[model samples]
Target: MNRVYILLGANIGDPWQQLAAARLEIEERIGSIELQSSIYESEAWGVTDQPVFLNQVLAVSTAYSAMECLDIALDIERDLGRVRLKKWGSRVIDIDLLYFNEEIINTERLKLPHPYIQERNFTLVPLVEISPQYLHPVLKKINKTLLLESKDTLTVKKHIHEHL
Candidate 1:
């Protein structure tokens, strides 16, 4: 089995319900979720005029390759009403493939150890919560270190505490 980390974000519709539904779809379509961070609420990253988004990082156990995982995640978003209106536009659901094991991959459709991991507080905080020691394949820094070094000033507040 291959382990992958994914980020789920939503700012439209019932955000909590959207996340729950996305999680279910991911488990069914992608793989078994071994670990998930508590949902974090933050201001929109790129498009600042939009509503706040609820985001979470999930560690999944999958048998699929990186591109396959990306395909499945994109399908889940489409099934759950994600539309490409504009860059960083508001959405019902957004799934970003953050990391696929320790392997470094770069393709037109996917990028491993997501290019923005070290720069976003919203992505870093929950990632640290679940796997603080997970190292970035390219940067060679742990999640906690990335979080500390992050220049993103966005205030990411934990929305729901997870038991596991």
Candidate 2:
């Protein structure tokens, strides 16, 4: 089985519940979930006119291939009513495959370790929370380093006391 990191986020209507539901769907579609990060509230990244988002990172152990994982993620988003009306627009649920083991893959539909995980604090913050020692295959640095060097830390806050 491969260990993959998945980033979950939602900004429209009951963000927490959307995230929790997305997790359940992943377990049902794939297999077991290895680890889950604490939920974090963050401001909008690309389009700043929308509501804040609830975000977290999950580590999953699965036997599925990269494309299989992408398909599962797309299924979850579609099932949760993810509308790609605009770039980084508000949505009901958004599931992104952040990393797939140490694989360096780049296809038309998927990119391992995400193309911009290092630049976004919303992803790296929760990522380092669950896996501080995680090493980036392309950057050759730990997650902690990425979190520290990230320049886009505007309004990222962890909601440790709340539930979806």
Candidate 3:
């Protein structure tokens, strides 16, 4: 089985509920969830005008290939009512493939070890919570180290309420 890390975020239409539903769909369609981080509340990363997003990181094990995992994630996003009106726009669900095992892959459709993992606290914070020692394939740094070195000024707070 290939280990994959996925980031799930939502800012529109009951984000908590949307994440919960997405988790179920992920387990059913993508892979079995091995580890899940607590939900985080963060300011919009790229676009500051949007609503704060609820984000979480999940570690999953699957027999599917990386591209297959991407396809399943997109399907889950669409099934959860995601409408990509704009880049980084508010949505009901956003499922991002963060890492696929320790492999580095760049294709027209997918990129492994998510290109932005090192730059976004919204992604690194929760990721560290669940996999602090996990090493980045390309950066050769642990998740905790990357989070500590992250320059992202955005506020990322751990949500007190449990949604995962």
Better of 1 and 3 by TM-score: 3
| Tens digit per residue, CA lDDT, model 3, 1-164 | 99999999999999999999999999999889999999999999888898899999999999999999999999999988999899988899999999999999999899888999999999999999999999999999999999999999999999988544
Instruction: Write candidate 2's Cα lDDT for 36-62 as tens digits.
Output: 988998999988999999998999999
- Model 1 TM-score, 2 decimals: 0.96
User: What TM-score would every model get versus the actual structure?
Assistant: 0.96, 0.96, 0.97
lDDT for 107 in candidate 2 is 89
Cα lDDT over the full model 2 = 0.90
Candidate 1 collision pairs = none
For TM-score, the strongest prediction is 3
Candidate 2 C-alpha error for residue 65, in Å:
0.7
Cα displacement (angstroms), candidate 3, residue 46, comes to 0.5
What ranges in model 1 sit over 4 Å off?
Answer: 161-164
Model 3 has an lDDT value of 0.94
* Model 2 stretches astray by more than 4 angstroms: 161-164
The Cα local distance difference test for each model comes to 0.92, 0.90, 0.94
- If ranked by lDDT, best first, what sequence of candidates would result? 3, 1, 2
Across residues 9-112, which tens digit of lDDT does each residue of candidate 1 receive? 99999889899999999999889999999999999998899999999999999999999999999999999989999998999999999999999988777778
